[model samples]
Target: MCNLYTSLYVAISVSQHISVYSIGLGPTELLLLTLLAIILFAPRKLPELAKALKESADIIRREASGSAEKSSVEDKERALKEVAEKLEASEKQEKKKRRFF
Candidate 1:
């Protein structure tokens, strides 16, 4: 019975340690990954790749901004048309009221 208890305790302790280890990594892991990537790609190619990525990101941002601006302008035009229609309808109603009175 004592030997069984000892074995169970050792197994539980080892499992707990493994769970803690597998939980997640921290900044050291990220730094190691960056270092590995740098070593694999070298310094010269990294700058060109980074520039291309930045350009692509800028293009996407510009397109998104332009679409947002265009939609806002369309929204404003629709709102103005709605206001004009409402004003015309109210003016007609006023004329009818005057005729009735």
Candidate 2:
């Protein structure tokens, strides 16, 4: 139920033209959360946490894009294979017809 709600929330935010999401928070909300974090953590600690978050987000983005590219390439290869098989079958049929005549 919460997962569905998060998905819907992100979808709505995207349609409304917000381009950034930070761990389920919109920009304004994220700012508020950051303030709260500052109150809770040391200034030095905040930079370390931010660096780790940025690295993880980068890794996730890279993997997601890589998988999407791989899937598209695989789809194109499969389509070409199917077309080749179809052409080969058609050629075989034509050869059989020619042989009979």
Candidate 3:
């Protein structure tokens, strides 16, 4: 199948050093492909696309980090609140016992 051939070509290409023939295309082919893509997409469009991709990635990263920080803060607040409530309840019980005696 074509996939098998492609995988084998990739494996041989990566394992071997940069030579004249490594079963498939090489850096020259990559350069040609890049040039073709640039020609097709236009140089002006590339920067805009790259900037959009970068901004989207940054937004995703920032949101993930923000949510994680928020969750951690919430967890700490809940723990402290629970501890305070327990202490207050214990103090109230002690006061009641003292008054009863």
Candidate 4:
């Protein structure tokens, strides 16, 4: 009974160590999902499905990159406007100083 208990404890510990919490699929899971996809979808339709997925990924990437570029351009424009405003203010200060002198 002691030996049986030790074996059970070892097995439970090993299983617990092997278990993982993850949001992403491992290779075996991915392979099974691929097999399931093959069984459910037609061979002729696979290419079209793959193409649609690629297009969607590309569109998402483009939108993300475009937003980054847009923000950068906006930052540059804001900085330029600030500098122009400061320049105008300094020019006005210089003109007032000239009038007093």
**Model 2: per-residue Cα lDDT over 65-92, one tens digit each:** 9999999999999999999999999999
Task: Name the regions of candidate 1 deviating beyond 4 angstroms.
Answer: 1-37
Ranked candidates, highest lDDT first: 2, 3, 4, 1
User: What's the lDDT for residue 49 in model 2?
Assistant: 59
Give the least accurate 10-residue stretch of model 4, judged by summed lDDT.
14-23
Off by over 4 Å in 2: 1-24
Give the better candidate number (3 or 4) by lDDT: 3
- Residue pairs that clash (backbone atoms under 3 angstroms), model 4: none
- Among all candidates shown, the one with the greatest lDDT: 2
Error of 4 at 74 (Å): 1.3
* Top-scoring candidate (TM-score): 2
Candidate RMSDs in order: 17.0, 10.6, 13.0, 14.0
lDDT of 3 at 49: 48
Candidate 3's C-alpha runs over 4 A off are 1-40
> How many pairs of residues collide in model 4?
0
Please write out the lDDT profile of model 4 over residues 45-86, one tens digit for every residue: 544554565566568668989999999999999999999999
